[model samples]
Target: MPELPEVEITRLGLMPLINHKVSQVVIRNSSLRWPVNLALNSILKDMPLVGLQRRGKYIFASFPIGTLIIHLGMSGRLCIASKKSAVQKHDHVDIIFNGPENKILRYRDPRRFGSITWTEDDPYQHKLIMSLGPEPLDNEFSADYLYEKLRNKSVCIKNAIMNSHVVVGVGNIYASESLFQARVQPHRPAHKISKDEIKSIVDAIKDVIENAINKGGSTLNDFFDVDGKSGYFQNEHHVYARKGMPCYLCDHPILQITLGQRSSFYCKNCQK
Candidate 1:
C-alpha cells in the first residue's frame, strides 16, 4: 500500500499542475475501491486548480468549486504524464489540465484499490478524513500524546501505534522499522511498556516516517514515484525484511514475527 510518505511524494510530483485549469477528466475504469463519480466531469470542467496538499495518505487537489481527494490504496500509483503520453493497461483515470507546461495527472492501480473521489463539500470535513488522527510529523503527534494514548491498552504496542486513530500513517513496514529503531519489542503489551520506551517509540515513529518520505518511500512489490522510479530507501532498512540477517546494532540475527497478520522484523537482542 502507498503509505503517507508515498502519497506525499505523489502529491509533490503533481504540484506542477496547480494553478492550471482542468481540461477534462478521462476515466478508463470506474471500478476502483469507490467508483469515480460520473458527476465530477461536469462539476470540475475548467475549474482552476488552486492548491494541492496531503492529509494522511490522501492527496487533495483544491479547486474553486470543489476538491478532488485521492487515495492510493494497497498498490496504487499516481503519476504526472504528458497529455500525449501512451496510456497503459492500468491507467485508470486522468485529470487532464490545460496549460502548456503542466501534465496529465494519472491514477493507476493494478489491484483497483485506489480511488479518485471529489467533493463540493469541504475536503477537510469529508467523512474519510474528518476523524483521522494527527499527521505523524506534526507536533500534534508528540510523545506526550502517544504516551497517554497507550496508557491503558493491552494490545501489542505495534498494533496500537499502527492504529490510524492513535496516529495516522504508521503502516506495517514503518511500524516494524520504528519499533526496531526504538528498541521496543513488537509483541510487548502497550500498557506495560515503560514511559521512556513509549517516548522513544514516539520519536522513532516520526524519524522513521520522515526519513522514508525524504527518501521517497519504500518500494516493495510495485510502488513507484510519478517519474517511474523505484525508491532507494530499501537500502536504509535496519530490520525490516531482514529476517535472518545480522542485526545492525547487536549482531544478533534479525527475527521476523507475525503481528496483526503483518510481517514484523526486529532484532531479538537489540529490541526488547
Candidate 2:
C-alpha cells in the first residue's frame, strides 16, 4: 500500500494542476475498494482545482464544488498523463484538466483497492478523515503527545504505533525501520517504555518519514512517484526485510518476527 510518504509525494507531483479547471472525469472502472463517484464529471466540470493536500495516506483534491478524496490502496498509482496518452489496462480513472497542455491526472490500480470519493463539507470532518491521528511529520505528533497516548497501553509498541488513532501513517515497513532506529524492540509493551524512549521513537518516526518522502518513498512493491520513479530509501534500511543479514553496527544477525501478523526485522544486539 502507498503510505503517507508516497501519498505526500503524489500530492507534490500533482501541484501543477492546482489552478487547472476540470474538463471531464472519465471512469473506466468504478468498482474499486469503494465505488468511484459516478457524478464526478458533472460535479467537477469547470471547477478549478484550488489545492491538493494529504492526510495520512489519503489525498484531498480541493475544488469549489467539493473535495475529491483519494486513497491509493495497495497497488494504486496516480500519475500525470497527456490527454493523448493511450489508456492502458488498469487505468481506471482520469481527471482531465482544461488547459493548452490538457493534462490528465490518471489513477491506475491493478488490485482495484484504491478509492475516489467526494464531499461537499469540510474534508477534515469527513468520516474517514475525522478519526485519524496526527500526521507523523506534523507538530501535533510531538513526543509529549505520543508518551501520553502510549503510557497506558499494553499493546506491543509496534502495533500501538501502527494504530491509526494513536498515530497515522506508521505502516509496517516504517514501524520496523523506526523502531530499529530508536533501538526499541518491536515486541516491547507500549506502557513499559520510558519517556525518553518515547521521545526517541517520536524523533525516529519523523526522521524516517521525512527521509522516505525525500527519497520518493520505498518501492518494495508497486509504489512509485507520479513520474513512475522508484523510491531509493529501501537502500538505507537498517533492519526492515534484512531478516538474517548481519547488523551493520554489530555482527549479530538481524532477526525477524511476526508482530500483528506483519513481518518485523530488528538487530538483536543493536536494537535492545
Candidate 3:
C-alpha cells in the first residue's frame, strides 16, 4: 500500500501537469470501485483541474464542480502517459487533457481494491476520509498531541499507531522503523509508555516519514512514481525487513516478530 510520502510525491508530481488543464475523463471500469464513477462523465470533461492535493493516502484532483478522489490500495499506481497511447491491462481510469500539450494520466490497480469517487464539495468529508487523523507532516500532528492521544491506551504500540483515529499513513514498515528509532519496543503496551518515550516516538515518526518522502517512498512490491520508476527508500531501511541482520547502531542481531499479525523488526538490545 502507498503511504503518505508516496502519496505526497504523487500529489506534487500531478499538481503541475494537471492544474489549470482541462481533462477528458475516461472510466473504463467502475464496477470494482465504491461510490461509483457515474457522475464522472458529467463534471470531469472540459473542467479545469483547480488543484491537486492529498489527505492521508488518498489523492484528490479538484475541479470547479467536483473533485476526484483516488485511493491506491494494496497494488495500485497512477501514471502519466501519452494521450494517444494504447490502454494496457489494469488501466482502469484515464484522464486525457487535449490542450496546448497532449498529456494523459492513467490509474492502474491490479488488486481492484483502489477506488474513484466524485464529490460535489470537499472530498475530506467522504466517509473514507472523514474519520482519519491529521497528516503526520502537518502542524496538527505533534509530540504533545500524540502523547495525549496515546494516554491510557492499553493496546500494543504497533496497533495504536496503525489506528486511523490515532494517526494516518504510519504503515507496517514505517511503524517498525519509527519504533526502532525511538528505542521503544513494538510490543510495549501504549499506556505503559512514558511521556518522554511517547515524545520520542512522535518525533521519530515524523522524521522517518519525511525522510521516506524525500527518498521517494519505500517500494514494497508494486509501488511506483508517476513515471513508473522504482523508489529507492527500501534500500536504506534500518529495521524493516532486516530480520537476523546486524543492527546498524549496536551490532546486535535484528529480531523480527509477529505483532498485530504484521512483521515487526527491531534490535532487542537497542530498542527497549
Best by TM-score: 2
Task: After superposing candidate 2 on the true structure, give the runs of residues whose Cα lies further than 4 Å from its correct spot.
Answer: 217-227, 230-233
1 versus 2: better TM-score goes to: 2
TM-score of each: 0.94, 0.94, 0.92
RMSD of each: 2.7, 2.6, 2.8
- 11-106: candidate 1 lDDT, tens digit per residue: 776766778888888889999999899877778888888999899988898999888898888878887778667888998988888887547888
lDDT of 3 by residue, 1-272 (tens): 77777777777667656564555677787755574566676667778888888888889888888888888877677867675567888888888876666677788887788788888877888888899999888888887888889888999998899887889989999999999999998999998898899889889999999988876633422343344553335657889999999999999989999988899999999999
Looking at model 2, the pairs that clash are: none
Which stretches of model 3 miss by more than 4 angstroms? 217-227, 230-232
Worst 10 residues of 2 by lDDT: 217-226
Residue 232, candidate 2: Cα error in Å is 7.4
Point out the worst 10-residue segment of candidate 1 by lDDT: 217-226
| lDDT per model vs. reference | 0.83, 0.88, 0.80
